[model samples]
Target chain A: MKNIKVLGSGCANCKATFARIEKVARAKGVAVTLEKVEDFAQIAAYGVMSTPGVVIDGKVVHAGGIPEQQQIESWL
Target chain B: MFEQFAHFLVYQLGGLSPASQLGTALHFWVMDTTKILVMLVVVIYFMGLFRTWLSPEKVRRVIQGRSKTLARILAVTLGAMTPFCSCSSVPLFIGFVEAGIPLGITFSFLIASPMINEVAVVLLIGLIGWQLTVLYITAGLTVAYVGGIAMERFHPEKWVEAYVWQIQMGEIAQPAIDTSLRGRHVFAVSQVTEIVGRIWLWVLIGISAGALFHGYVPQTWVAGLSERENWLAVPMAVMLGIPLYSNAVGVIPLAEAMLAKGVALGTTLALMMSIAAISLPELLILRKVMRVPGLLLFVAVLMVAITLVGWLFNLLN
Candidate 1:
């Protein structure tokens, strides 16, 4: 199972990103533990200045805006 | 060409007489909506392509240790160019501080990022003209510059959250964006999609409100407010705009309508700047990283600067 974390302060874009990632993972039948990180310090610790950042298994995969469906699929 | 198209669509096709108020308002709405939307897509796409190279990380690195004057200039410029989302302000603020950027410089970025943006610029040029656009940009940058200096005077470093100073930022591998021609095209396309998706409703609402004002609001009432004797207009406009909490995109069309209705330029400009720059939600977010005093000072500085800009423009006009 992949550990996927969405980092944001619960903005609309972040919520949308979380939902999209989950939907894509489920559709791909990929088992993943999804977590939402809303803490600003934690987000900055990863050096991700933009919100709705995606972290896959401790690696920063995306930052700033929602990831595309195809990109999410490739991650899965 | 847009005017002709709107004329054809409203009068020729819809069979609405141009003499009627509803018809005139509908024509204005259609023309402005189409014109502004086209301009937005093109301008935003190009801007996105250019902005793909800029990130907060890079901005932090550049401004980290520059001289005060040089840093302030760069901060405001990059702040205007950077495609920033207010939701990310907290992390961005922490990142800048962790990178050892000055508090004043950070405030400069915060002010310019929202107050002067591509959407506002493009819409201003489309709805109004280049002269006002130039004035708006100049005023925004000046406010940002002066505001930064004033913030630094307070020595606001002490007012930052204690935890923010303690947190050490770690280097993380950033996802590399595709930088080829095709990649830029894709990025720009996505930018257009995302931006238009987010703001289309607001644009429509703005244009509709503008249409109503244009069609129905009497010029004499607007004149009363615009009169030089009415010294309260600018401050009143600034105060009235605080609760609106809108970005520049939604306010420009309404501004255009107000200008057309003979409202004073300064009052309209004040309203636009206040709505774009100060908002309750953004303030609440900033509260996480700044103590109450720092936050209050920040707001006070912005309020005074914006009010001064309003009055200066009013005096000049």
Candidate 2:
């Protein structure tokens, strides 16, 4: 089971990443729930200072950039 | 000898006021000086805590994700939330790729983290009110989003060192550690001290300069010479800011004073952002991580993008 956090201001990159994640998840039949973290305070709690961040389980796995599709699938 | 004498006379004639000038200078100095001292301790405290809870390597190792786009979006959103100052950015940048963060996505995070912060937002809300504050937030976030995508498109692989792209071995083997309340308190004080120590001077300079411009300079000068009329204000301001560094937290107070003197919101913001993001200080720091060409490209793109943002904001208002 994977819990996904797509952290960013609702912008093109944020939306694009969510779309890509969903695409890969659906294709791979992975069990995952995507949560959108928009509040600035909550994002800080995770110690992330960049947008479009990804958190899996309890740890922040990505903060500055987007990872590739295959990588997401593998993580799932 | 003639030029020296002429300059001496100009200084004497520009006399404006003694008490008011000193008072204004003091007022600006105290306000910004306080921020510097506080931020210094805060940043250093965070550093100690950072070291305790997250190893440099462990911190690097943490942010590895699946989808590139999702990661980028998260980075921007996260950037907005955490409100990173310039100081925190360096170590984090070093640790990020070591943790397996991607380049294009990292760019998004880097752009957003410092641009849209809580301190900036609060200051904006208080000084300019909520509407413009929202506008600023929207514009800042959008830049991170679009600018990030643009960077991805151009793919400046040359800018990144070969080693920076690959994951570096971290302190994964270290024993589990926990930081307590007393330790946290000490860390916070130190952070305040460190950040304040360095930036106090900047705060003073920013405010006094702003106050002088506020009280003395003709308000018509800024309003009259706007881009719609002069065209050069935008680029000139941008160029000026690129080589200078100023914090939004510190700059906003000055900006408020400037607006009081008839300076338009757009021009003030443009100059502020330029000083914060593309300034020489930030650029020089970037040089450590990026080659000259890569640095230039980043500066060029960011400068053009922020200027347009400032312009659109003025138009809307």
Candidate 3:
């Protein structure tokens, strides 16, 4: 199963990425699992320095800021 | 004759109960006001002082390489002294790694940066008494020291990205600001207002949370779980703390609130420090520099050590 992580503090940017990811995922009919990681330690494990990050299946796809929906879709 | 004198004095000074009440109120007011005022002064003074002494490049140079016992100590002590924010945590990592510092010693720097900020320390003293103030500082410094040393022993250098090594080395210049005695005072006041004023909200939040725990959370409940032997509470606190990014500012308000609510001082403080210091956000940020294994080890060591510290304080106090 594809696992997606939207790592953020529920900020607008973080939510936006989640919405975008959800939109992109829904369009593709991907049954990927999504989770929000807010913990500092877990986030460090991913090695990302910025919020509004995206991790697909365990790879950090975006960091510090939100990437475009298309970029996220590519990873999915 | 003495009895008569006592009676006359009591009559002159108003009723004994009223006099006693006045004395108690005065005592509390003096204590509260002084701690707040003096702590503000001291934090301001320290901030300005660092404007002269501390630098990231210097920190890198001091802690780098094999002879690291000294470096770890300096990193924690000095790391606590600096006023950088979570955003700056990344830049500092780049600076330290480039300076040839060991992974563990740099961890010391990272933990201390936010956990023991001056604002948190001073505000702590202001709200709580001096004993806890000293205890927090000592515990933070000790954890950084011991934790860093452990990391170095079982060292993992593979975690860092090769890109950090590619960045050009730049010298850390001394602080740009300087002033006379009067200028220092003015600088101190301005720094107080600037730094403290900015984070007052955070302080309120942290203290409030703490106060809530203090007031509502039963000591037996925390004591049951937070004891050295307890399996659930320590990990839960650390796990809960990991994701949250509560700055010193946000934390202080919660602390105050917890204390007001009768929360166990040690337990709330332990959880609070964990959030502010060993936060998952910081770990995630650090992972960019360190591998997953290294990051996990760091977090594990910190969790155990801080939980132990919390347990010990609870027992002693």
TM-score of each: 0.93, 0.56, 0.63
Residues A1-76 of candidate 2: C-alpha lDDT, one tens digit per residue: 8889886656445676788888898899988898888654354456554446677886666654344565677678
The superposed Cα distance between candidate 3 and the true structure at residue B235, in angstroms, equals 3.2
- Sorting all predicted structures by DockQ, with the top scorer first, yields 1, 3, 2
Off by over 4 Å in 1: B11-24, B172-176, B213-225
The worst-scoring run of ten residues by lDDT in candidate 2 chain B lies at B169-178
Which stretches in model 3 have alpha-carbon errors above 4 Å? A1-76, B1-38, B64-66, B170-175, B178-190, B201-231, B256-265
Q: Which lDDT value does model 3 have at B186?
A: 57
- Model 3: residue B208 alpha-carbon error in angstroms: 8.1
- What DockQ results for candidate 3? 0.02
Positional deviation of B57 in candidate 3, in angstroms? 2.7
Higher-TM-score candidate among 1 and 3?
1
Instruction: Encode model 3's per-residue lDDT on B108-157: one tens digit a residue.
Output: 87778788877777787767767878887887787777777777777667
RMSD of each: 2.1, 16.8, 12.9
Ranking, lDDT, top scorer first: 1, 3, 2
Clash count per candidate: 0, 50, 54
- Model 2 error, position B98 (Å): 3.4
Write candidate 1's Cα lDDT for B204-262 as tens digits: 88778778887888878878755554668888898888889888888887787778767
Candidate 2, residues B55-137, lDDT tens digits: the string is 32343343466577776777777666554534334435645655667766667767776677655665566446678788777
| lDDT, candidate 1, at B232 | 86
